[model samples]
Target chain A: MKLTLRVWRQKNADAPGAMAAYEVDGVSPDMSFLEMLDTLNEDLIVQGEDPVAFDHDCREGICGACSLVINGDAHGPERTTACQLHMRSFRDGDTIDVEPWRAAAFPVVRDLVVDRTALDRIIQSGGYVTAPTGSAPDAHAVAVPKPDADHAFVHAECIGCGACVAACPNGSASLFTAAKVNHLNVLPQGAPERESRVLDMVAQMDAEGFGGCTLAGECATACPKGIPLQAITTMNKEWLRAARTSKR
Target chain B: MSWTSCGWPPYGRRMALATRDRRPPTVRTLWDSSVGKKTVMAVTGLIMLGYLVAHMAGNLKIFFGADEFNGYAHWLRHLGAPVLHSHWALWIVRVGLVVSVVLHGVCAFQLSRRDIKARPVRYAHTKARTSYATRTMRWGGVILALFVVWHLLDLTTLTVNENAQAGHPYENVVATFSTWYGNVVYIVAMLALGLHIRHGFWSAAQTLGVGSAARARLLKGAANLLAAGLTIGFISVPVAVMTGVVN
Candidate 1:
């Protein structure tokens, strides 16, 4: 398949970026989106032209490292990470637009890579359960109910991909923050620091200059992990409860 | 279990002296957070929503003719008269409503600016966002604000209302709705109000942390009901006048 790619390119973080079109010939339909990019990059290297820069690691869709707004969708037209998105999803001779995640908190670092360290700072604020630094405890030591464990696991799927922020018109990180909060807040082991976990993480999220949740559900739509929008409501509930009851 | 539930940071509390030196997070500090601002919007919006329901119900009194409508208007000023002075209860409600409106508008303005700033750049390929009512909320709010001004001038102050007279609210309402521009403005604003409430009511519930997947359908149904009921109820007055049913 020969296709036209309008890929965003920038020299560095301080440099301006624009869509630079490149034509790739003989692209196989079985190649992943990143592999297709590899094809284009090889040709660019052969011609001594600077190849487009993007983020990718693990390439298995779990690292949350690949951040691309392909064809206006977070990962692509499909519901998976960019690395897992195959070229078969597109028609032959199609034109694709590739760009970085758009959010002030997740500013574009170069091409399709945005600094998502803001999310790490939010997790630092409290996204954890308290345990002494030692060897792992017995799995059955703490008995969490089945429903609660399911709830925790459901939300724990968030990969910190920042697609929620990219898809959100407000560029809000509510879904990301909610997933982190709910993943731990539902477990028996997590019950100890539940209140502070919510409060501090939410405060950190706000401090990072991320936008507020408007409940538009775009975040959930773009999320590759299928983190439910209800995660946000749960976070809101936790935050409110903490605000009212937690001594802090 | 967690640091003896002192609400202090457990790791820091290991010092035993840190508890005395550290300040706990309070509602005061929380208010400065974006979440708190949203709470303010949610609360104020519910206040206004409640008032709109009552306002629409009161407007329905027009169907009972000038006596019931005029009597209801008169009763408003005399509300709580035995204990509270004449117009005192009315003034209190007026003040409360003013406060609600001001706070709601201020928070909406600030949050909107922040929301826009958070997403500084736009994607090259854009897609339409959310529902029409959801996307149009900001402009709908602005339109409602301007409409409130016209409504007050036409009804409350008896200014801009050409055929206005004192103490005859039924007649004044009829006169206001009697004109072409009046009907046009009233209908348009009422439509905007419906769209606003459709999104705003559900959004307020989410912001207040009362919404969940289980309650989502119920809350949405209520929002639609309220939006439809109020719009139709309020627009009935202008329709009544235009059709010479009230006049």
Candidate 2:
């Protein structure tokens, strides 16, 4: 399959970028989206042109590293992440417009590559259990209610791709953050630092200059992992309690 | 101070003026119109909800004693640390709250209108992606607004109407709930408030960009607990008043 690719090009963060058109011929439909990009880069290298730069690490979609906004949709209209998206979805001679995730916090590094360190900062703020993960305790000692366990598992599946942020009109990451908060706090072991975790993570998320959530529902709609927006609501309730209790 | 386009020459100002024609095309507005209003609605709605929680807490002081409840309200009217709370301060807060309410209503109306206009063709199978709180935000706001007005009339106006107790402001609350309709409305409104608060609490965090997985989960849990508490607190007032628990 031959296709026209209008790819975003920029030398660096400070440089102006625009969509530069490239025509690639003799492409296979079975090639994954990233694989097609690899082929295009190989062709560019042979012609002494700088190949497009994009972030990808485990191309299997679990790493949340492959970030691309195909056309106007994040992760290309699929419920899955970019790495899991295959080229067969596109038709012959299709004009594919590719761009980086647009958000103030996730600035474009070069071409399709973006600096997602802000996500890491949000995680570092409170995404972990403060309780010492010591030697293994008796496995059957703590029995979690079935519903609680299911809810925690649902929240634990977030990949932190920033798709929720990108898809959100306000560029809010509450859905992503809430999932993390709920996942750990529901378990009995995570109780000690639950309040502090909520406070620290929320504070860090704000400090990173992410926009507020307007509840437009687009973020959850675009989320590859389908993380619910309810998680953010849960976080808010905790913050209020923490704020109030601390004042006392 | 001067026009520069990346070393490219600016189009001739005279040429631009010539191209400036009468009857300028009406610029189509996107989010700055629709989604922007929704944002304002979401934000102000959250503020109003915060006020509801605080207001309920204040009202629930009646459970302590009439003197305590009255003192709480009186203190609110006169309780500013550096500057004493006065009639003017009370009115100012009231006005501010009213303004927030109005802004919330206007933005909601505009956003809903846009939503209706944008999608004239309804989908065959479309489930609203909204949560319970978001789905009922408008209804909750309306209920709260009505409650505010009625509550003021119940306390401030002291109308010697048949429905109200003649000389007792507290008794009016009791008498209103003694009837089934009054209890029903109050309970229903509180439920609406619960729904609103459930969504609003966490939404406020998201709007402020403080949402994270752990924090969000905690916030949602807290919001549910708070909503339940507020509902019970508000409902307890009517229940207590009707049962003659409070003289």
Worst 10 residues of 2 chain A by lDDT: A239-248
| Backbone collision tally, model 1 | 0
Task: List clashing residue pairs in candidate 1.
Answer: none
Q: What C-alpha root-mean-square deviation, in Å, does candidate 1 show against the real structure?
A: 3.5
lDDT string, candidate 2, A52-148, tens digits: 9999989887888878888767788678888888888999999988888777777789998988887777776567764435688787988999989
Off by over 4 Å in 1: B1-26
- Off-target runs (Cα >4 Å) in candidate 2 are B1-247
Estimate, for each residue in A1-248, the C-alpha lDDT of model 1 and write its tens digit: 99999998887889998998999998998999999999999999999998888999999999999999998999999999999999999999999999999999987888877899888878767887768767988888888889998999999999999999999999899999999889998887888878778877777787788988877889999999999988988888888788778763
Which candidate number would show the highest DockQ if scored against the true structure?
A: 1
Q: Over the stretch B34-75, how does candidate 2's per-residue lDDT look in tens digits?
A: 323434565776777677778788877778886777666667
Q: For model 1 chain A, give the 10-residue run with minimal summed lDDT.
A: A124-133
Query: Please, what is the whole-model Cα lDDT of each candidate in the order they appear?
Result: 0.88, 0.70
Please give the DockQ score of every candidate, comma-separated.
Answer: 0.47, 0.04
Q: How good is model 1 by TM-score?
A: 0.94
